[model samples]
Target: MNNELIEKGYRRYVGNKIDVYFNTNICQHSGNCVRGNHAIFNLSRKPWIVPDNATLEEVKRVIDTCPSGALQYQEK
Candidate 1:
């Protein structure tokens, strides 16, 4: 696997924020992250992901569902 991409996928959120960075390459496109939680994951957009759009708890839940480890988060 590419470490650079992995690092890029790992994001940090500030003060109880949700920070999600989905790596397209690593993603299986299972849609679990996008479909499981519409409030946070929206596949229709250009970026297709805005971690800050959802709460930290919600984002963490979705990220955990990612089978490919494509989504990652950190708290600051």
Candidate 2:
């Protein structure tokens, strides 16, 4: 029983990998995720990154655009 697998289960079918945790306290609302696809990441919404909204591959592409490591992805 891997905790990482459990967390990823919460958002299964969304992405190939998952972003475990992110500290937004020092994060600046860069809007990198939303800029490309509002359907995926919306600052106005809760749990900002909506894996269910878009395919995992799409999410990965946007995540790479993040200037800050504030966004991360790990395989389950």
Candidate 3:
């Protein structure tokens, strides 16, 4: 886990190959994330961002669409 991100108010979502980080304060609500991959970014889900729901490449691809810099990731 990244203490720095946590300290910055970014929640961590652990995965086998990568860990996802999300800061809601910085989210632009562009809907790009959910549109890019519903499986990984489902709003109706409890933990909306599930990195393991998709492949590493897919996760990266979807997160890259976050124009607000709200979604981030660190590969394990």
Highest lDDT scorer: 3
Ranking the candidates on lDDT from highest down gives: 3, 1, 2
Residue 14 in model 2: lDDT: 36
Q: Which stretches of candidate 3 lie over 4 Å from their true place?
A: none
Task: Tell me each candidate's TM-score.
Answer: 0.70, 0.63, 0.95
lDDT of predicted model 2: 0.61
Instruction: Give the per-residue lDDT of model 3 (tens digit) for 1-76.
Output: 8888899899999999999999999999999999999999999998998899999999999899899888889999
lDDT of 1 by residue, 1-76 (tens): 3346456764332334544555666778888986778856776775566667777777788789889987776644
Kindly state the number of residue pairs that clash in model 2: 0
Better of 1 and 3 by lDDT: 3
Worst 10 residues of 1 by lDDT: 10-19
Clash count for candidate 3 is 0
What is the lDDT for 76 in model 1?
42
Residue-level lDDT tens digits of model 2 in 15-71: 435543344643467877679788877777876666657776787788788776666
Go through the candidates in order and give the C-alpha RMSD of each one to the true structure: 4.3, 5.3, 0.7
After superposition, candidate 2 runs with Cα above 4 Å error: 1-17
Residue 40 in candidate 1, Cα distance off native in Å: 1.3
Which is better, 1 or 2, measured by lDDT?
1
